[model samples]
Every structure is written in structure tokens, then in C-alpha cells.
Target: MSKFIPLSVPNLKGNELKYVTKAVETEWVSTGGPYVNDFEKNVAEYVKAKGAVSCQNGTSGLHIALLLCGVTRDDEVIVPTLTFIAAVNPVRYIGAEPIFMDCDDSLTMDADKLDEFCREECILIDGKLISHKTNKHIKVVLVVHVFGNMADMERIMQIAKQYNLIVVEDATEAIGTYYTKGKYNGKFAGTIGTIGVFSFNGNKIITTGGGGMIVSEDKELLKKAKHLTTQAKSDELYYTHDEIGYNYRMTNLQAALGLAQLEQLEGFIKTKEENYNLYRNKIQEIKGLTILDFRADIRSNHWFYALHCDENYPLSRDEIIRYLALKGIQSRPIWGLINDQEPYIGSQVYKIEKAKYFWERVVNIPCSTNLTKKDALYVIECLKNAV
Candidate 1:
């Protein structure tokens, strides 16, 4: 087949064109406009957060979240090592060090291990969780809803409460995912945390080319994030500034697109869920491969269809990825364990064994909502043949 099956791509099936054209016609193309505010409001309403702040991208949103969480230099933040590096980069952006933690089979931070790390490696000082290294307070716990699978939030939140750590969620891939039963009932993924962020990148379940949004229950923090992104300008008409700021604000054009995309967010979730089920049924029939399960109690948007290579798999992850590439199918291995990366080599990490194991076996398959059933079937066939 000449067609290249991409791992993920934006679905422009909604009112994206109409909204974008209107933005261009109105000349509302800059970082400030009605669309930007409307998009922020739409997301906030959807996630049930008090307020939302749109940023240039998820990384920027995360950076804003870290700043809001008070992640100062050399302070330690516990993060999962098995996720996309984008999720953990914000910890470093705040000049804080990340303490890499392992992930469970659900592909989220292993709360069990995190509790162990906190109880054993961390010391309590003056009602704050402090890392032994650098003697700085370990103020935040950054947890990711990996591959659209909800993390063990109950346990994670419990650990955070017990240790008095602020929870920051990287829900970039799990925007529509939510836990059905918990203290956070009817709660969306990002809203459950102290602060959360979502990515609107081209590769995500939804896209505005590139954008992100920060949400928080604290109204003050949300205002602060918005202020920081818009150069901390004190006046609307006058570009007067109070604090040093960043040009991380989301553009009007992108916000227009995001608003359009948000209208189809539920439809996209349906398509992605269907695609995941199709892949799961087909892959399960083949030996030595299993699709990672979403938590049974929650509904997952299934942003990715991750195939975990069983112990007796015929091909290594690298070999399978190469095979998929040769067939014009784009497959990706999991991100490198963050702690193992050269930039983070000396950062504190504990009980990283499982995360490292996943790094070698997890492969993200094509899971775009734009992928048609026939295209999905072709991928299923290719996997069976390759195996």
C-alpha cells in the first residue's frame, strides 16, 4: 500500500473550517480574541474546573502548572519515568529536579511504589515532604494518565494526602477520560488534581495544530497562569507589565480551531474507543501480545493503542517497529525512561525497574480518530503477519 498509516493525526471533521475562516475574516488572529476566551471557557465547563488558561502547548501548560505548584530550584517532584518526556520536562523548567518513579501495568505512575519512595526515601520536616537530596521540600507529585488510561487516582490522591504533597496531573492524553467511582465522582481527569494540563497537539486525540490549557480549582492560580502567559500585562489596552512573563499564550487562530475540535471531542472519543476495541480483539487472538487495559471503573478515550510485547513475543519492539515502518505503518516505541536520559542521569529515582521494563516492550500503534475501519483492519492484518 502506498498510503502511510500515521501513528496519530488531527481529525478535522467538525466546524474547524468555519471557525477558522471566521477568525481570519474578523482579523482576530493574534494571541487575544473572543475565540481564545471561548475555548478556555468551553474546556473549563467540560472538565468542571473553576477556570482554565490556554497556553501555546502542553509543555507550556505544564511549566505554568509547576510554577503554580511552587516547584522551586532543586526541589524534588516525583514523576513517572515511562511516559512522554513532555510530561516531566516542566519539573526541570521550574529548576526543580524530578525523582523518577515506576509505572504499573496500566502505564501510569505506580502509586504503591510512590508511597514506598515517600515513606522510605523522603523525610518529613515541619509538615512538608522533603527529599533527602538538596534538602529542598518535595512539594509536588506529577502524575500522568498514560495512554489515556486513568491512573490509580484514589491511591495516588491518598498518598498525596498522607504526605501533604500537591498533585499536578499531566492529562495531556486523557482529556475525555474520567473516573466513574471515587471521591471525584463525575470528575474529569484533569480536574481531580490540584492542577492539570491538556495538550492540543497534532498527535493528540484532539488538535489545534499546537495548543494547551491549564485548569485549576484555585481561581487565583488560574488567573496567575493567564497573567504569566500574556506577558503579565497589567492593562489590557496598555502593555504595562508587573512581573516577568512568557509569550506562551495561545493564538486566536489556534483557539478557534480548538473550539471547533472540542465540539467533536465526544465523537472522536467514540471513534478512538471503537478503534481500540477492534485492535484489542484482533491482537488478543494472536499470541504474545496484549493491549493495555484501561481501568474497568473508568471510561478511557483510548488515545493510544499500546501493544505490550509478551515475554514470548516473536520480535523485539525495535524489530516490530521496523517491520511496521516497512509496511508503511507508523509505530512508535515507548519513550525512554526519563531518569535514564543523559540530562536527568543524576536526578534522584527509586524503584524504576518496572518502568524500564515497559520502555523495552511497549509500542504505540496507530490510533488516530481519522483512521477508518478498513485502515484499522489492514493494521490488524499486518500485526498478525508480522508476529
Candidate 2:
């Protein structure tokens, strides 16, 4: 019975109008234009990547990244079962199989389990890690930075190196997040991995209406991604094709919006951090409820705020979400485990321990970047009263 609080939404109160108007006035609204190039360059610089290629959306970016990783019809990619379906669907898009792994307390893929699965469950043959279960070559590790929390990239990278796995970071929720106390202390989330992808969906920390970017330290891979996203034309003038490609480039208008969004991303993250702390402070006093934290070692974007409803709490995760919804406040349970989904029912899931625990008890509260302190307190109050 108050102002509706959304779970997450874009903050578009910056140069969005100016840049988008320029694109419209200049009539560079299609897939090609200066804004597109500018957006790519700016994002590359922001993330400290060698280069970035703009794509239609994060899913398409993942598809192109997997294609460039040489993932074939039967190859396997290690992925977290605790992520949105979009993260794993791209594996299927490439006709590859996904070896689902569980999440740790941070809700990111468990690096220790990942290492165990590679060392004890798989075999190394001719410098390739072959899954003994499926007998498929595990060529890549697609790690999603769940809810803007950075995974244990340090340990995961070590494991990846040991097993010859290409690391692809799905940093759709963690654009500005970076390490503060590790080997990659100064690196951004998307830059540390072999290839990284970002999303600008409506519900993400930032939005280009709907767009994504692919970044990589390898310039040649970035170049190939750019080429492949644009129909894989060897000769642009004659439209000559060298290989199969996708029409996945971002439009100038979308890029215009993205460039503007990138400019305000730091500010957005600031708001998110403050609001998240506010939620944490308020929710801590409520019995049997704890606000899930981002990894303490990294500066997170704080994209979404999750609360764990333990047995001490009287409400179920679904009950809390439904109560909040009835009161005009939006909250949601964590995504259903991807491993349990119909498409991935037959896929391999290893040591799914913490994922099942968090999946049932974690409820994400409203955490939009534009959410005010008062809004956050209101949501917290609603939660406290719901109990």
C-alpha cells in the first residue's frame, strides 16, 4: 500500500538523451555508426580490456564468445547451476554440453569444487581435461559473476590453467566490480578471464535498453568476435563471407544509450552500495533473516540485495516474496537451479551442495540503483513487518 519498489531497474538520468538524440539527428540509428565504435572503445577502457565488441545482447555475446572458444557440438563447458538460464543457454546454442557446478556462500561458482571436479573426476589426456562421466573434452569454464559478486577467480584461474580451460566471465551483473585484495587486485571482473561478456538488459545495473559487450585481453579474439558478430565478412565492400556469422552487433542508438549509461555507472554503483548497506543494517535486526553479502575482498556493484530466510524466520522464501508483492514491493526468490530445469535435466551436476540451500532460502529484495535511502528503509520495514 505504498510506492512500488522494483527488484532491479536501470537508472537513465544521465547523458542518455543527449547521445541518443545525436544518433537520431545524425541518422546513425542502425547497427553501424560512430556511437557503436565509441561505446566499444569506452567499455574496453573502462574494463581495462585489450578490446571490446558490442553485441545485440549478453546471450548473443556469450554465443559469439563460445564460438570463438572453439566449443563444438560435443565439447563441454563448466558452468554454475545457480545462475540465470541465459548463462547456460548459450552453451546449448553452440551445440555444446554444460557440466553444471554448484555455488558457494557468495552465490558464485564454487572454485574449490571446480578444482576438485577437474582433478578427481576428470582425466588429463594430451593436455586436455576429459570428463570421465561424459568422456567429452571440457574446453571452457563459463563463470557467471552472480548478482555482481566476483567468483574466486584467483583459485579458479589456477584450476583453469592446470586443466587447460578457457575462462569466460559472464559479468552481466558486475560491470564495475573488481578485486581489491588478490592477484587481480586492480583488475575488473570481465578483464581477468579469457573472454568476458556484459549485459545492458532493463533489469541490469545499467541498460542500453537491451545490449551487451564482449571484452577480452586477446586482441585477436576480440577482432574475431567483432568480425563474427558482423556476419563474418572477410571483405566488407563485397560482403564476402569467410565463415558462419551472426547479426549480433549493437545498433548506434543502443550504443548511444550505453555510452551514456557507462558514464554514470560509477555513480550508480555508489548508490547501490549505500542502499545495500542500508538494507543490510536494517535487515540484520530482524530475527532469523540475514542480508547476503558480496565477497569481502572485492568492490562489488551491489546489483541485487538478497536475504537468507533461515529456520529462525517464520516465513518461507516464497511466502516473503508473495507478501512483499501484495504490499506493492517487489521481491523474488533466487532463480530455480538451472540443473533442475527441463533443458538441463540430463546434464551433469557435481556436488550440488550449497546451491540447493541458497536457492530455497535466498530472497532478493528491491535494489535498483535509483532507489533512495527512504525507499530501501521502506522495503526493509515491509520485510520486518512481513514476519
Instruction: Say which candidate scores most in TM-score.
Output: 2
What digit string (tens of lDDT, one per residue) describes model 2 on residues 173-220?
899999999799989999988899999999999899999999998999
Candidate 1 collision pairs:
none
Tens digit of lDDT per residue, candidate 1, span 223-266?
89989998888987878899878999999999999999999999
- Taking all chains together, each candidate's TM-score versus the true structure is 0.97, 0.98
> At residue 280, what lDDT does model 2 achieve?
86
Quote model 2's TM-score.
0.98
Q: Rate the local accuracy (lDDT) of all candidates.
A: 0.89, 0.92
RMSD of 2: 0.9
